[model samples]
Target: MNPLQKRCLILGASTRAAAQSALYAGYHPVCADLFADTDLCTIAERLPLQNYPDNLVEQATSISPISWMYTGALENSPEIIQAISKHHVLWGNNAEVVQAVRNPQKLYQVLKKHDLTALHLREFNHPPPANSRWMLKPKRSAGGREVTVWNREAESYYAESHNKDKLSTDYYFQQRAEGKNYSALYLASATQTVLIGLSAQLVGCHWLNADNFTWCGNVAPVLFSHQPEKHQKLAIQAEKAGNVIAKEFGLRGLFGIDFILETPFLPSSFPQLFPLEVNPRYVASVELFERAFDVSLLKWHIAACESFEQSQQEEFVTTENYSANFSAKAIQGKAILYANCTFTFPLTIERMPNCADIPSYGRLIQKNEPICTVFATGKTIESCQKDLQERSDEIYDALKIKE
Candidate 1:
């Protein structure tokens, strides 16, 4: 460890991406996650947890005082965030902010007030019309876990077997929005919000071994459509929604909004963006944008948190600037390759290029769990996605043979 370098603690399900960003931003990162991947160990100090999330607070207490931040899933546990924040300078949203932003009801109210389209939500007590399509989502979940399309018949069976009232608080129904999924990244200060870039989301990809609404990966610099007018209109809507949500929740630092672009069948109609969920911290797709734009998002995130005012306006990248600088031909993407079968990871995987979140050599990876991430780049979205798929296949083939 460099004595002159400042230490930053990162906690998440996978901290490899954030750790890399921290390194590029000139901070020595101390990380703890579900998997202390081989690549992560090569870059930053790793603290293994006997029981993830449950013992995160205990482990965090053992580290020396330093600034810290959390990534996905942790936002679902505001109490844990609150406990850890007492010991370190938090460089991300506080527990209160996390709670407010994660609350579907609160987010609904904010969108309604702004006259923006929001995902229709139905609590357990109020069942939706049987004909309308809706999805059942867990109240405390991340990465699309436990999310399923709502079926009236299945719901009836569940109601008979379980206590409806008890389950009501834990789950809710959201009207299904059929369209392409996308996420918009942003940086917010006390008074201003800047759009970083937008990415196309990959959900429930069977090829990646992800099932039933599970998040798989992302492709950056996506547009609503090939038409220039339609793309610009959609981008504007996303920017408007981001600014409103950030101001309403007092969100500071980097955050992402996962939304759906409801493209109309009629050419005369413009596509509408339905804001689905808010990830009030550094999201999974941040690295794709970082690669596409060649910028250190963590550096900007920390800067935004430390300085609340709009004095660093010149340094921030807005939606207009992002659109202007983004190349129409270049595309970057990543896919989280999940294990199709349980097996011990080969040591040779540590040397593979363009792969991240690599597990330890000889680590046991169970069926359907993430193995590592594969990256690719090309001149178009199709080529980029194709390259990522080919990379995933190559990795899987290597996993088949014993070292």
Candidate 2:
């Protein structure tokens, strides 16, 4: 079979990055996503998801006979996965695995029973203590949408202010854990799981108009050469917890573990790390891995899925093997610039490297909508962050959106 004829269908909220990676891996990508932006259209034939989960299979069939992979929001609905798997080769985690990890209550119970690092979580049936700081998280949501503080001042008015029945099972509360945010990315086969890379997740950058927990981007190699031993220990702990979760849930292909180190960078006392949630799909950080190691992550992801099915791990390269090839060439980061107010794209769009999810010209962008994605790569984290800020400024300035 000709490799170019191996059509890979990609679906997600926005599949530009994955589509790009698929092209790099020598596959003909047929994409169905929310934003068929200019960049994505340049790479693959666009298929419209006319009715979403219901139309997913039909839309895919409309394109060609091909294997499919999904991104962010699709994992929340396992029924959709099952439905799609009936017709197409699904290249990621299946319905059963998604069910195990997507349920917050079940995941919390597993973490507590296994003696893994975890935060204090409570059911929404009862109100949290009036004095304690708590966060209300949707049972099934992503990219930090709708995550907010459970304000004590509004405690008494909870029942009167909202629907009680919907609150019980739709959401839960957790005592806010203070710490430095990080994510551990890994690959899993049926027999074993491999830790791939660690990254510092960028959340709530004010410049991007993102909320406190809204995911912005990531910087790979969380622990640089000069970091202390304690930081390295944290990374190891993350891997240990990741391995446990992958085995527990039978997670296959690409997965990420969100974590928090309970203290600042240095001068810490009694630092504890807590594992947050298990993201059982390809995350934003995969791009960072591809940039740092000069390898196609999407190809590895597809390969991992195939390898897991055969129960053979020999075909896959270990994370350590990839790490050995890593050099201190440059640090890379990607930031999503969100709109603070309504605006329209300028007449002339400036071309930028790694920029994606671009809004079309003359289109009205709403408040809080993502304007576009910008990227930066440098010899140091500081330099990379600086570059991101400058590029973001340029984007906002061109669109006439203010802070």
Candidate 3:
């Protein structure tokens, strides 16, 4: 280890992306994650946990004192986050903030109070109209896990399975908003927030063997292609929502908003943006932004957090900086390839270009488990997606053969 290099710890289900960002920001990242993929191990020190999330704090305590941050799913565990923060400098939202931000009821109230368009939360006991659509989502969730479409039959089955008349407080029903899914990345200081990047989200992509709201990947700089006007409108709406959420929650550092952009039936009518959830940490989609804009998002996240703690009011990074670097037509994307059946990884796949989170040779990957992440870039979104599909297909073919 270089004695002079700053050391930071990154914790999450998969920390490869955040670890890579930390490296770009000139820090030596010590990572504790579920996979500890071959590519991540080559770049950073890996702390193995006997049990995920549950053993995170124990594993973290063994490391030398340093500033640390979490990636995904960890944000859903405020108690664990609180425990870990006791021993290390927390550079992201605290437990209280996590609890408040992750609460659907609180988020709905805040958005309504600010006069911003908010997603309607349906009471678990009160069924929606027969024609309406709703989604049942876990209060503590990540990567769209445990999310399902709400229906009368499904609701009844859930009640019977839990042996209760009502759904557990751990889950809630949200009115389903129809549209294309998108995510906006924001950098916030104590006093202000700025939109850094917006990308089209790929949910349950069959090409990657992902299904039922599982987050597969993202394509950045949503080029509405010929619909430039719609693109501009969505950007404005996203920035406004980011600013509102940051102020309401006192959010600092990096956060992401997953939203739906509803293009109305009439062409002349403007599209409406419906926010799905707020991920108040370094999100998975930011990596696509980094590749697309050539900016170190983790560097900005660190600066924002430090500035907030020091009572600095100046903006950490402006929206202009991100926009200036973005090309109108160029797009970058990443897809998480999930295994369709149980198989052993046949090769040392870390040697492959444009692949991250590579599993070790001969590791058993179960059905629906992620195999690796594949990346691609092109002049248009379709071309980029096509390249990603081709890469995913090649990997699937490899998984079919035994070593």
Candidate 4:
């Protein structure tokens, strides 16, 4: 694939993160998923869309797809990926490496070999005992879905829901690991690496339903900064784990890692960081940044996918200080990022009336979706968050910001 001639397509671009990265990277970057017009597509405006005929993995992976598709879960997407070979064409990770992290039982053993602590887990084809508390997960899945607490009447229930939807016997049962989860989006090549962005908190927990699938938003970096040193340590561990998996798959592009920060066995000490799994693609954080920064992430990714390295010849640009925020769930159900990037806003402001009167303190003026991602790198996170909220409150309520 000639570096200049190659292109990229990203799966799991439902969120703004992947779209932002691809767009900024300079590729209109194709967006593929079951959900159309997701946040990713709205902002991308022109990213191509692809729908599969059940065998999409084979189709999507059979080429030099610019930057690798950052679809969330590939292991569980077996039907889509049943045709994986020794290597794939379009930019992406090695399928085998993805399978390894998907199997809960296998993952636990792998963790032990790698000197990492993981949840106490097991797999049972038959129903579980009442006192037996194990969290069951699809052998390969993502986004914290179908995870259930230990159940005793497992057999009858299992028979009823066995082949329902994407569920299969290939599923595994384990202890419901509990702890705070976070995401760190990373981009890497054989020789180069960069931590592009990080997300606040992860949602996908279950309490009473025994099955939890929801975005538990707003664990922003602002809140985590209360314990800065500890948070940094965990981020390091997560990046390392993702790197190991990327290396294993012989990967060479953008991806993400999921982790659990929990109290160590030694109670008095700070929480011990543990690497949970790898995403092998772009994540929501980057998508949020794309809108907040108004830079195309896809451009950089495409450059890398085509060349297998960032351009030393051409210069790169980034904001002095910016954020991909979406934490106003307390006030609004969804999130929209309002930011000032190297482009957009100020240039378009003169086009709209009363735009100057509104709080354009560098707040992004575009608001059209469920989540609002904002960027404000003032002296303090509190101040940034406050400014973002004021602008968000005004925009969220105004008819002009409406779709």
Give all TM-scores, in the order shown: 0.93, 0.92, 0.93, 0.62
True-structure lDDT of candidate 2: 0.77
lDDT of 3 by residue, 1-403 (tens): 6787899999999999998899888999999999978889999999987889899999999988899999999988899999999999999999999889888899899889877778789766665653448888888877888888887667567668555644677787898888888899898876668888788889998888887799999998776759888778778888899998898888989999999887688978887998899999999888888877777778778877874443334334434345544654369899999878888887846567788899988799998898899999988888999999998887766666321
TM-score of 1: 0.93
Worst 10 residues of 3 by lDDT: 309-318
Candidate 1 per-residue lDDT over residues 316-373, each given as its tens digit: 6543334456554468899998887888888878777999998887899998889999
lDDT for 46 in candidate 1 is 88
Worst 10 residues of 2 by lDDT: 319-328
lDDT per model vs. reference: 0.85, 0.77, 0.84, 0.48
Model 4 lDDT per residue over 1-403, tens place: 2345435555552434555455455445555654443344454433333554354555555555344454655545643443533234445554555565555666567666677766665555453564545566656555565556656555446557553533356676655445666666666655545565555543532211112433333223323556778657666666566666555555556666666667466767767655555666555455444443444555554444455334431333233121222232221111233322222233333232212122222434332212234333333444544554454555434423322
Please list the residue runs of candidate 1 whose C-alpha ends up more than 4 Å from where it truly belongs after superposition: 130-132, 160-166, 223-226, 308-329, 401-403
Model 2: per-residue lDDT, tens digit, 228-338? Answer: 677667766877887788888888888898888787557755577787788898887887787787777777777778744443455565443354456634688889888
Consecutive 10-residue window with the lowest summed lDDT within model 1: 314-323
Q: Model 4: how far is 181 from its true place, Å?
A: 1.8
**Clashes by residue pair, model 3:** none
- Candidate 2's C-alpha runs over 4 A off are 1-5, 51-54, 153-157, 161-166, 264-270, 307-312, 315-325, 350-354
